[model samples]
Target: MKLAKRINSSSVFLVSGGARGVTSECVITLAQQYQCKFILLGRSPIIKIEPEYVKNYFDEYGLKKSIMEYQLSQAQKPTPISVQKIFNQISASREIKNTLSRLRQAGGSAEYFNIDVTDYVSLQAKVTHFSAITGIIHGAGNLADKLIEKKTEQDFEIVYAAKVQGLENLLSCVNIAQLQHIVLFSSTSGFYGNIGQTDYAMANEILNKSAHLIQQKYPNCHVVAINWGPWESGMVTPELKKAFTERNIGIIPVEVGTQMLVKELNSSKATPQVLVTSPVFPPATEFNLELKTYRIRRQLILDENPFLQDHIIAGKPVLPATCAMSWIINTCENIYSGYRLFSCKNFKVLKGIIFDETFVDEYILDIQEKAKDNNIQEVEVFARISSEKSQKVRYHFSGEFKFLREIPSAPLYTLPEEQKDTIPPWKDNNFYQNWVGMLFHGVSFQGMNKFITFSQEKFTAECFWQKIEAKQQGQFPVQWFNPYALDVSTHPLGIWLQHFYQKSALPASFERYEQFAPIPCNEDFYVTTEIKSESDFSTVADFVIFNSQGKVSARLFEVTFIRWFT
Candidate 1:
């Protein structure tokens, strides 16, 4: 996870659950950091009431005792239900004013609205006033603690309405296209399940699943559901607090809890549902979950697979690392249930698989779910190639997959300036095929459209889907990390050596490589390569694939290319 871009000052945030709870605390911190406007929502009513003051009338006789008596009498005075309601309203208004004051002092604006989140019509009517809401923090929920058998249907409805219905209503009513951040407050009860929190757990579980679905739909937005543990706040009764203390389950301090929230907001790779809790608690596996795995094999042939044929080195067809990743990813997709692969870490190509007429081989793929902690899962992936005669297996590709609950929002990247004015566009129609020595069929399928700039130290090329009739662009099985597109990204390396080295060269090995994010198939990319070092035997370089949004989809680091000589 990279450092997350901070919230813009122009953006407005909406926080539910009220002006004086955990949600409000998080909003106040965000307000201070970004100095953005906020609209706080709750179901409390507003009423005008002033602080009562006492006027001294008489008596230097027993002055201290008399004043104490007067105060005691005022405090003990009985009031009707109507008067009590007014007092409650006044207290709520004061709390809202205090919250607003704090935000204003920190150079941000804030407003409070009295509306129930479960009431869609009222929420919609109220939300229209804040048309520029760029983020939402939905933290409204109720707690009805009871054993499963003793729990009432009404109890379930009340708890579910706050989180499940509240989230549904917000998602249905809001302008999601404009939203950059969507944070849902979940709980450990929902994630691992507790004894007396059936409704609460169910509601929070809905939040976690909802975040996963929403993230898949909106990959560019930060959709997070934070599953928090118990905190030392108004919600915890004295008996409950004692029980927790006895069990050694530490209650989260308000300051610490808010800080964790801020940390989540600042991380670019935050998982969809982050379980912000202590390590001493019960493990998530207590709920009994099954791990997912995929196993598949494919036969490769040079005549049928033109991609391998095009990527030849020293008169022998060699499989590219990107294609290996494509095979693994595609296999995972065939058995995919709910999880989606987002980022690849520590990716490396160990050996090169050379293909010849006698190179009839089978490629095997396996992706297994390994470790499960909180809301994140670690998947181990492997792709191997072998033949019938020898038991020798070449493990061509290996990487760890971080399955995301919420997709990391697309980043705003700085594009490298194209030096097109100095370098003329390479306008040869069959440039990759004729000049670069790559086969025509392979180049077209890989979506190599045009060259932007090429030089010794730096190179930039453009890749787009071909508009030609009957030409299929990006036809590879693995569309998420488009190995064809990745191959296109490395086209400059091939062209640079072909133009300057006086000999055709193929990439034999890569020293190291990593992918920050998955490459999207639809967008046209500007592949930028920089020469880090060069010698007669080998050339090492780094390259980045920037999408149409000028954001890097994949970055290859310290790629050591051993020259292919025949």
Candidate 2:
């Protein structure tokens, strides 16, 4: 609603991460509904998405194919920094032309600019070139694998440099003329450090600082940060993921997230600094084509490891036959908060951190109503440096929460390690040796030396299939799931096998517990949530944590009784 209103029947937009994830959703939404033209800039070449799927979407909804379809993947070419600098200008120019083309087709057109947002010079050029920049929604940045020992002088410099440059670029350019509005996607990862995401956290902080800069430099523009919980993007190394449990860093369902973003952006009546993310941002008019106001839900997993014995129900409790189901859900919510999320290693990166989910909503709302509000065209996430404010404390650990999913066609409970078997772990392809000792578990699981298939995301079926079909593909080697994480959930045991594909170095989706059912099983809990683009169903999960014991303890949920089908 806010977007529909903010974006007139015709507008022009530039989507940084246009080819994948949330950016893809923004592109599709802008194209389909508002008929906004876009300069969908991605490093990759034109993508060959099965347009049939998109066609089906329109047909299903009685919509039109106004969506200008194209494709882009991260264009890979490790050129010198100088050559990259030149490309930034050239790329920006090319993107502008493309964006303008899209706009003209949308009826009353505009321009688009493509630059390596990770590159500063290009960003400045792009910004200065666009005068009617109404709103900016930034969603571009790199997620570095968190490795303390691996941290090098060059890596550190590269990390902060991009962040510094991007902001400088935006600030310098926006000031060239009056700006309208902006949205920055910060992550919970920056709030805390997960096992292998030191760089990621650092980069995320840069996003926050950029928001501050926008407020400071572009005072007239409505600038805000959408501190996201996590989505399947950015950086996460598989081996490093095993030690964390919160998994909130990149666990947002793309569809729901996009909708929330649309709603928040649309509800210009209110402006917020940050929002934890929920269905209801009720301070303004609610124009949802979907149902219900909002809710957050969780399933309590009871552990029998005696390690969780203390979390058991306090008293003898009632007999299994006459137990109240409501009590079970209520108990489960508490248990989930305490044990699973608060202390879960997967999400330790976000522990002990503070953020204002409400702030984001409120801030956006305030900005919408203020006289300073202007039309925003695009937003960007840039690289940044670590601030020296809280340096001394080595934050190896923190706190968290968990939200578990119910298996559809709900079945009986199984043991924690009881998952089906899958392909065993393979040797680390690159000589990095971090995963060297990991084959031990793989040998146990698959009984042989397994061949690797991938390492750092970016491979897709069309890309990898050709590799598999190649005889000389030996030199074009691939690593199987990282010893750290894997998506092989079909195996009785949900193994953490991970290989990069589509998103990043991490397995885009962790195949936890066979399969996951969509949220809202017991409708009384979650109001519901999916769609921005093909990336609509993409997901990452956040666990709300609570502590019940010395270890990461959550209240374990149990089903004491159920109603008869009669």
Candidate 3:
């Protein structure tokens, strides 16, 4: 388990609802690990002395009976509600004292405040004095388990006020600039609505959204709303636990739940909201539907796609063939949830988009479902793009998409033995300067770092994986397939054509392409191109892209490039 390096003994943490239950368990873990100072807040007041009758009773049933007997001896009527009230007060005080003692034993100091967090004036007055606080864990929340129709207005207020209004009051008093971390304890009910937790779900969802908004304003602060699933402790009663077990919903252990919070704080990747649920949750099942053709209209302009300016051919911007393939995969993935593109077959560019003249009408992407197998969790779809020109449809590109339930594992790749007669490798700058003159790709697409091996039949090169900004990726941003990396991997083939045939070439079509994993950006990877066949008009080849570990990430089979003669 990785620990957060940023947290130390001197760090001061402010936690709400931290004197008892699951929150107290987490507080103890933090104290044991970091030995930090904590300010714990709760609504229960400390009990210095226990009543004589309740002192001897530990269990709830015994305590209730003892309280009722004491009330009878006092010549008073013992109502059920009055007996339950005294029992609750005794239980809360003992829990709070046990938590405080554990914190001290774990080598941490703590200060407890008995105040309702929903009371803004009192909360603000107490919080304003804490100038040295470094982090905040907003874990205060109440649950009223009643259906919407049966619930009263007071029930909703009690649940919502602790989470929503409490957070507002805390933030209003704290110094935002002095804080380094803000963790909101949201719930899975907020993410996936639950039947009897309407008020709870609404309050938690507000916390999730607030985390995003706060992160945008304070970019340096680590803000995250963890939508945790049901846990083994806290509000889950025995009856509720049995119900969850019958439904096959897994319960997170107290130790595992606290450790996950530490891991989340240590992660370098910043995500504003995340759902942390156990693996026992049910898998997604396919929805039955009738086969239908869906058409999406889109208009491409040179001003919108600035990266196309780098892909100039004959003084005109031309869309790379890789971008067209990305459109097909992204569209299909968006249509269905819990499905990913497994492979694309028979991808052909009949008439590529060239900005020789501005178009006045929108282009249409037509997708039709060909087949679906729910048991296998696979769907086959055919996609095509066309535009109406003078009342006639001019087809641009077409392909077949296969979406599967899971992404396949990356295949192993071994570098082929080099030929003895092959020339020494060319440095990146020297080869790219000559290659770009023929291919006309700009800096954004120029990813070749070094040419390692070259021969008549095969060649290998190391290419830098450049990161594309969201703004520069155009309307069809890189999702499943990165257009820039794919385009750059084909550079060796372009160099081969220029070296032997003295002509530039463009990708015409490919028989099949498979993506096992996403290509990592801002790193270097190896590209190996093997020439299958060559002709005067076109060249057919296979390309394998892999990392330094020799794990094949993607492969293009029987890719045909049409030679250009000008």
Candidate 4:
């Protein structure tokens, strides 16, 4: 299993996303240590040119800026920025050549290919021209970090496709029989879940699963999916590095990470998955992995409820779904020892918990096992609220939570786009709260400032966080969006529903719902809704939250709201 003795000149390593970032560094380090041949594949075009052409080309553009200024002063026209940009690209190509030269000088061989991994036809043609691919190191990924509501369809496609589709394209063209090593880079976000990496986490998790499936097909081949933590790489920008440091998470030095990669490849470990992280990122959460499920009880009171007060609808103070989710999740963290809730799927709210002056409600929070394997345990979380006067529980909620089994290796992705239209900013008076009969006292967090557009089946609105007293910020990293902010996101939908029926409506169930990213309370975002179906007493709809830049940041699916059948 030792890498040094096995890797040789005859061994041709095909590294996708090899021309830049950690992938390039790893390849160069391996080449220096193992002296093996490498075929570097990346999206950047390989700059090929004759030596004489380089000399003449730079001689023209490399003249002193002062000289060019003088030349321009004597002429009618000035040099354009476009010309300088071309020079910059040419300079970049030269750098690539220098990197290749260094690889050769270090007693190793390498060739660069400018190709996109997601393009199957191009990848197949490129790999066919080369000798049999001895190994594959896939490290390509994209980041489109938005709260699920703000994420666009494009954001999800580009981010998810890069890791999933890229791998599929590479695997299809490569000869599985000759493939020796398959190392898929994943992240901790994908392992547990991060605040703003829903698409990324989903994509990387697929990589981990794909590795498992591939190993089944080629059992003898080394197929390792390394869930990497934050390392000193291009993806770890200074801002992110500082954020990690603030949280006491340490960054893995490049040399140390590469060494670990070498160790993983050399070690005779049969486990196809590994996690690499230091103490700083998610912080530590205490839990007993030995105990598979957890059960606890809690109480809800109207007088004591400071956050839920503003959610008054139809003269009744009703609990918001986001608040309910946060309460249940926070309790789980407290009991199980602080594990962050990365995602919640198949979330359903069966009934509304309306507060009455005379009564306090008791609730049960139960965590039941759904699935468990090496690094992750998926649990079904249930919450039931019951009144003291009646034995029957009035409301129920359920969802799934994933605890980390492996570190994640996905990169930070951001999808930013223009708003696409020039519309007047939303004004304060335009919020539906002014017209609605409900008094959102504790729930004022849902106040919206602008209505972008509205249709029978679709709606969009803009909302800003209502300033609260300094003491009310709640816990660090805010478990979810401010309940009121999330509440307001559904306001437009409620307004749309009013036209269909005369009775009051409140969210009754949220099925196939997911919180891909967190909605920051301090920022402004858009809320969009699409109605899926309607019945006599209920309506099912999907909602999304969009950041200011028009990218979806969060999403809800199959959300059903019910009215009393009159």
Q: TM per model?
A: 0.46, 0.37, 0.77, 0.48
Window of ten residues with lowest summed lDDT in model 4: 405-414
Q: Rank the candidates by TM-score, best first.
A: 3, 4, 1, 2
Off by over 4 Å in 2: 1-5, 9-15, 37-114, 216-220, 232-250, 269-272, 275-566
| Number of the candidate with higher TM-score, 3 or 4 | 3
Residue range 394-419, candidate 2, lDDT tens digits: 22111121223211232222112212
Q: Rate the local accuracy (lDDT) of all candidates.
A: 0.68, 0.34, 0.83, 0.67
Ranked candidates (lDDT, high to low): 3, 1, 4, 2
lDDT of 3 by residue, 420-466 (tens): 35754444355657666465788778887766678778888778868
**Clash pairs for candidate 1:** 272-406
Q: Write the per-residue lDDT of candidate 4 for residues 1-566, one digit (tens) a residue.
A: 32222556667888887767777777777877888888877766645763332444455455334334545666735466644644555665765676678778767898888888888888898889876678889988888778899999999998898899999988888788778888898887678776667999999999999888988878778888988888777477666666566556677788988888888887776567788886433544433445465656667655556555556655676777777777666665554443445556667776556665534556666676555443343333444433444554454566665544222332232333334253333344444554363223343465665556656666676677665653443321145334556666777665565544544467766765445455646678777788898888788898877676555556778888886432
Backbone clashes, each candidate: 1, 101, 0, 40
Global Cα lDDT for candidate 4:
0.67
Q: Which stretches of candidate 4 lie over 4 Å from their true place?
A: 1-5, 48-92, 280-566
Query: Where does the lowest 10-residue lDDT sum fall in candidate 3?
Result: 278-287
